[model samples]
Target: MLLAILLPFLSFMIRGKIITGIICLILQFTLIGWLPAAIWAALSLQNARAEKRNEKLIRAIKENSK
Candidate 1:
């Protein structure tokens, strides 16, 4: 919940997704586009988290097989 609200700002501050953050920042200024931007940020964050989880799981499986 809180993450969705802060993601756009954090993305820019952390320099993770500069382009997406910039687009969201610009959309935020429009007021109406803010929701879409936030939604986009949230979805992006979710995908990143899932990818990280997958990587960790793969690493664990590889270590156990050895």
Candidate 2:
């Protein structure tokens, strides 16, 4: 819940995606763009998490195979 509120800032600070953050910030200033920006941020975060999980799983699989 709290994360959803600050998604744009978190996207920039934690994920280091300047462009995403900037886009979110710009969208926040507009009437229609706010929701889209938030959705985009959430998706970006989800994708990042999924990528990390996949990387960890691959590493684990390699270790197990060895």
Which candidate number would show the highest TM-score if scored against the true structure? 2
Query: How accurate locally, in lDDT, is each candidate?
Result: 0.73, 0.73
Each candidate structure's TM-score, on Cα atoms with residue i matched to residue i, is 0.77, 0.80
Query: In candidate 1, what are the lDDT values of residues 1-66, reduced to their tens digit?
Result: 366665565654464766767777888887788778777777777788899999999999999999
Clashing pairs in 2: none
Q: Model 2, 1-66: lDDT tens per residue? A: 357455565665566777767767888888687777777777777888799999999999999999
Task: Estimate the lDDT of model 2.
Answer: 0.73
Candidate 2 residue spans exceeding 4 A from truth: 5-10
Q: What are the RMSD figures for all models against the true structure?
A: 2.1, 1.9
Considering summed lDDT, which 10 consecutive residues are worst modelled in model 2?
Answer: 1-10
Worst 10 residues of 1 by lDDT: 6-15
